[model samples]
Target: MEQLVFYSLGLGAVIGALGVVTAKNPILSVLSLLWTFFCLACVYLLIGFEFLAVAQILVYAGAIMVLFLFVIMLLNLGTSEAADFDTARAMGRRLPLVLLVGCTLAALSILAAQQVGGTSDEARADLRSVGSLTDLAQVMFGTYLLAFEAASILLLAGTVAVVMLAKRERRKNAA
Candidate 1:
């Protein structure tokens, strides 16, 4: 039963990821990402990490998704012009490379799963305790507090840089 559930969630995650990749519309891609995040939360729940699951849903599925939608709307990307892409030609050129990469990733994932699956019941108990909300909070606010703040600062700097570059390009085009 557990294996069945795990496979189902895994399949859903894969499908959601494909949707995000294949959808031409950014909004649709974001919605697909939301589906993927929800499936991730479900997987966390199945693994006995209730706090992590709730945090995933609340942070990624709710707040992050809302922010994504807000930014998409603000950008006013109402219509996307079709790219001058030759799908047949591009597919012919890239098919082999894509297939090779996909196969490699699949093999790696199988190997990783095998390695983790070899863990004993005792290790799983430790993982459960280590992954608890209190432990996570301590790590984030105690041990890694400086690192966490630095990451946020870096993200803010990147955002400002992008906005400035966009404004500069807009002004140049207008002039």
Candidate 2:
């Protein structure tokens, strides 16, 4: 069961990564990136890192991706009629990079798996200690309180900046 979940998440990450590179439309790419984050959250879940998984979903998938989509929509990036795919150019640029990144990630995963070996009962116990939402809230509001507050402030600033940027420009007529 664990192996099944690991393989599924690995495949999902690969597909999402490929979609981010190969999708011509920017909106599609953003959606792919969202999938990538979601797959990562799943990977965290498979390892019994429940708090990390929920944070991955809430922070990256919920907050970050929504901000990305909003910025993309606000900028109106893909509306130009002249924008079209240059398949040869895209393939030439992206293929080697993709292969290199994939190889590196595979190597790292293998190395990490070898180091961690199989899950132990001890590890499961430790995971359980920090697994619940209450445990997460305690850590966030206790040890990591300052960092959490800073992140909220940053998000607020970003929201204000986006609103200012989205305001329509006024044109003046010549007298």
Best by TM-score: 1
Off by over 4 Å in 2: 79-85, 118-135, 141-175
lDDT of 1 by residue, 1-175 (tens): 9999999998999899999867778799899999999999999999888789999999999999999999989987653542433267866898899899999999999998787789998987888877688888899999999999999999999999999987897788989
lDDT tens digits by residue: candidate 2, 18-137: 898677788899899989999998888776778888889999999999999999889888635424454578568887997998899989989987755677878767756677667788
Clashing pairs in 2: none
The alpha-carbon deviation from the true structure for residue 102 of candidate 1, after best TM-score superposition, in angstroms, is 2.5
Q: How does each model score on lDDT?
A: 0.87, 0.82
Best by lDDT: 1
Which residue pairs in model 1 clash with each other? none
lDDT, model 2 = 0.82
Q: After superposition, how far is residue 124 of candidate 2 from its true place, in Å?
A: 6.6
Can you give the lDDT of residue 45 in candidate 2?
79
